[model samples]
Target: MEQQIDSLFNWLDETTSIIEQEENTPYIEALIAASNLLFEQQVPEDLEPNYRTQLTNQVNAIQFSDFEREARQKAMQLAILKGMKGATQQHHYITPETIGVFIGYLITKFVGGQNSYRLFDPASGSGNLLLTILNQQQNMEVDSYGSEVDPTLIRLAFNNTNLQEREIEYFHQDSLKPILLEPVDVIASDLPVGYYPDDDTASSYELKAEEGHSFAHHLFIEQSIKYTKEAGYLFFVVPSFLFESEQKDQLQSYLKEHVHIVGVLELPKSMFQNEKFSRSILILQKKGPQTRDPRKVMLAQLPSFKDVEATNNVITQIDQWFKNDR
Candidate 1:
């Protein structure tokens, strides 16, 4: 499986390099290569004939149908990670696989018994995290939806899911703006942390800052809560200091009124280069008759992912808390 993933990624890399020779950006090159893999035919029309032939030959050599779902997903993830590294845009970073897998495990614990449910990711960049969760929950039917404002990322997302043969309805617009979507049962996202530039749109959010641009992550929390069903679950990858900024009071007040805190699991500090850039997974449930604040909020610092035994121990503790305490 590892060898297949590496080979598939190598093909993608070679094709992307060929396309890059035509002066396309890294993101576009990846998109083109992935699209060709999905459709089994080259899609770009303006490349030099030799380059087009080379891309087509590379596509012909691989039998994408032979790769397993997880293998294909991992290969595409590597391809996207490469593009992200070359991208100048700060928001292009792909959610790490470890984080995606951990979020999937948590979601499965809560929703695994359901026959079917809807899930949404408002800040779904290239569809990696959303698809990762979906891939992990193959036993249950999931109606997935995603929204993104960046054209390139959205295009890449469409291709990514299409290649995996996963169905998802996507909204290509600013997630903060009003979206025509039905409320979902589960919401998961690696919330983009920063100030939202559109003050006018921020104006409509209850969590909007009293002055100046509002924190985008805060607004995303408000938006996710708004589109969630009664008692639905929300898992967010947020900065460690989410509630320590200048806008903490307002955010805390808003959360207090709208949702029950389920838990906050601080990610391993070793995963990040600096403590200031560290993050945590925040678990919350929308306020409803079926929901109540956990008797004891689940809080713990995760050990480095490299420490397999310690990580599993923490996971076992989390499992027990859900089974016996919460």
Candidate 2:
């Protein structure tokens, strides 16, 4: 499974490398189609006619290999990580595997007993959360889906998770909008934080939109929960202000009526370290009337900064909390 995943990333690197050199080539669509073919063995039938032609014109150039692919993919991922300076500009905040894996572990504990499940990330930048979730559930079958507003990151994410037999879907659209698919069992993401132009369509998120300013992270949390099935879980990495500031009260009240606050883990101040952002993980469960309990919540603070062992211990502690509930 790992080798196949590596090969998919290699395809991403190769396609992106080609598109970078041919900036005027309109290769993004073709690259995406080619990747679909490489892993899924077919292009999506809904692709436009022009995109199909563009793909046909470039498909032959995509080479495949059994041995060299893994190393090449790693090189490509590293290159993008180091060279894609615009990643942050595009709101592509990559979650560290350490944190992501811990979240995945908790999510696994919550939903692991099921025979199968669907896990989604509303703002799945670069597909790290979905990939991490898959890593934690090596023995379980999971259908992974995500949506991103940036087309470039969407392509990168689609490329990263397009494993041979894995079910993965990447949508290049705003996650604040409703997804047409059925509600998922688990929704987890490092919610993008910042104020952007208020999306008119997001008027439904009453508390999230005010006058001309809209806080994106709040909206995503609402949207994520909207698509989460009853009793489904949601895990999000959000700015600390969501818990500390006056702005949080409205959303908090809204959540109290809709979902159960599973826990709020305040990360160490150094969690974002050099990034100038303080973050916390907020866990929630979509509740039916019978399951709603506003007081049933846990609050935890991570250990001292730079202590990996202590961090792991905190992760284990949280994992056990969820385990006890099960």
Candidate 3:
């Protein structure tokens, strides 16, 4: 579905009278009100009364108090989140369209010949990755699910999907925390990278955490693994350090025993919009305790992000590998 995000912004700009305002709280309040109206209009007419009412109440409860101290920065950051401005990629929220498309194609090929499947994104920012999959797999049927900690971004994601007439199940909760849901067939996400304050403790992520450090990103990966069904595939973007970090040896070992590392696509340094740290896409498949011979993990280096042809060429190679190997 076409994003009418601009229309939402226009409504806020006109009604909030904050077109020239410099304050953050006012803009946030206006945004909350506009978001409610946007979702209200997009909600399906045939939706169950209780479900629709619950959604409407959630929209109504979007208040200034819902945001933390970084309210202004969050508001400004929405531009990048919504693709209104080019993403710098330093934040936990930016999922570029190129990366989204690449992962979408992976999902399509991995689920080849399947008419319908469930797709989940643990850290779905504005539902870009999930929506990209819906666009790519138009001929196939899918039920999209996602969870996010940020209320603003989740609101944007909700409106984006609903506006397109795609009914998605989105949870406004931290993906790093425990969530009980039906296991899905495919799990794909640009996992949130970096450490932050969270309710999930370091002890819970003993597999991926170092002493005195608890990474939300690792917890998200753990959750993704937990939610994926046996034999389901998980496609995630993570820091390159994970591949070689001595601190992550235990976590790597655990992963090796539990799932096959199908492949790792090394991305460009500029892939995160000039972030110096490198990133890679790790594709894994869940397995049972039964022993199986390990297949060669496909490792391919992508060309510079600026070279569109080179990037597409690498994607083609990756697609061929998935097709032939499976």
Q: Give the number of the best model, judged by lDDT.
A: 1
List lDDT for all candidates, in order: 0.87, 0.69, 0.67
Clashing pairs in 2: none
lDDT of 1 by residue, 1-326 (tens): 99989988887777777667665556565555555555555446776788767776877787777888888889888888777776777688889888988899999998867999999999998899999998788679999999999988898888888778899999999999998999999999999999899999999889888888999999999999999999999999999999898989989988999999999999999889899999999999999987888988999899988899999999999988988778
- Report the Cα lDDT for residue 307, model 2: 88
Models, CA RMSD each: 1.7, 5.8, 8.9
Which residue pairs show backbone clashes in model 3? none
User: Model 3 has how many clashing residue pairs?
Assistant: 0
Candidate 2 ranges with C-alpha deviation above 4 Å: 1-76, 86-90, 163-165, 274-276, 292-296, 303-308, 323-326
Candidate 1 residue runs with Cα over 4 Å from true position = 27-30, 42-48
In model 2, the worst 10-residue window by lDDT is 67-76
lDDT of each residue in 264-294, candidate 3, tens digit only: 8887776555554678889898995563434
Q: Write the per-residue lDDT of candidate 2 for residues 1-326, one digit (tens) a residue.
A: 46655654565656555544544443444344445555554444665686555545455545444424334334334544644644448474567666776787778767766878898898887776677667778677788888888887787677656532346888888777767678999998998887756567657786655566677777888888889999888999888778665567878888887888878888777665554577788989899755755444667887754687987787677666655643
TM-score rank, highest first?
Answer: 1, 2, 3
User: Model 2 scores what on Cα lDDT?
Assistant: 0.69
Over 4 Å off, model 3: 1-32, 35-92, 196-200, 206-210, 273-275, 289-294, 305-308
